[model samples]
Target: MFELLHKKINEIISLTDEEFNYCRTAFTPRKLRKRQYLLQEGDVGKYQAFVEKGLLRSYKIDDKGVEHILQFAPEGWWVADLYSFFTDEPSSFNIEALEDSEVLLINKSSWDMLLQNVPKFERYFRVLLQNNLVATQRRLMGSLSETAEEKYLKYTQTYPDCMQRVPQHMIASYLGITRETLSRIRKQLSEKK
Candidate 1:
């Protein structure tokens, strides 16, 4: 369980075995059943979860009760409401398990402590946030400039594993398109191949 966590951390910075062990002390392993809610709208998010296995999604329901998926976290990814976790404010998004999931959870307090104890962790988190920001910017640019088919192709090429794991309708939601549009796109792609 800690292997992925350790590897991910090492990719950001070299941590001595002792430092890794200290960092490990701050995390708690959690198992979430499929469809379980890790966070609900209006509740403050307390922890950031590192996905060890399975999938989770963060979404918001509009006034019409349609779920708009914001992001998906598969194995080896991290998920959380950063605004809610950092500010202790209620989150507008809900994070739910798409499949039975194993995760390592680090509470805000523990994260702060870890950063103080191991300054290198600050660099790790900084890089993580930078990468997330860059990806988000690219997604926003794509949404503004790309056609539905273009978006669909980009998504599949970038996250082919996610297409296999996530449901079609949810993927459509994330792409800001109707399920019918997604089906058409898939059919078009298949025909072209």
Candidate 2:
């Protein structure tokens, strides 16, 4: 049941079997249907989830009520509103399953205990958060400087799997382009190939 979590954690920090077991004990397993929300704006973020199966996304609704996707979390990924999860703030975004999903959720209390009991987890999370921050920065930079075509290319290169997993319009939204523009880009690329 903990196989994917074990693999993901091991990729960053080597944990003894006992440490792994202890860590697993802190998390509650949850299954979400597609379109079900793990979190929503105005809710105090409660838990960070480690994805074991399927796909999920975090997004925001603008003042105009248009949805803007912020991130996609496939298997082996983690998703949460870090601000809410860390600061007890109400979430500014929503996290929902894009497909039926299974995840391991650790509440703030459990997270604290896990970090204390398994110190290696500190390094594991630091690395994970660091990588996520760097990636977010890179994406922000790309969005400002890159063209629609470049954005699409970079997105496809970075997340080839998402094409099959996420709807095209969501990908377009993430790229900051209109869906019709994305369609044209796809057509141009297909013709060249």
Q: Pick by lDDT: which candidate is best?
A: 1
lDDT of each: 0.94, 0.93
Estimate the lDDT of model 1.
Answer: 0.94
Model 1 lDDT tens row, 75-110:
889999999999999999999999999999999999
Sequence-dependent TM-score of model 1: 0.97
Shift in Å, residue 95, candidate 1 = 0.7
lDDT of 2 by residue, 55-155 (tens): 99999989988788899999999999989999998999999999999989999999999999999889999999999999999999998999999999988
Query: Which parts of model 2 are misplaced by more than 4 Å?
Result: none
List RMSD in Å for every model shown: 1.0, 1.1
lDDT of 2: 0.93
Model 1 regions lying over 4 Å from their true place: none
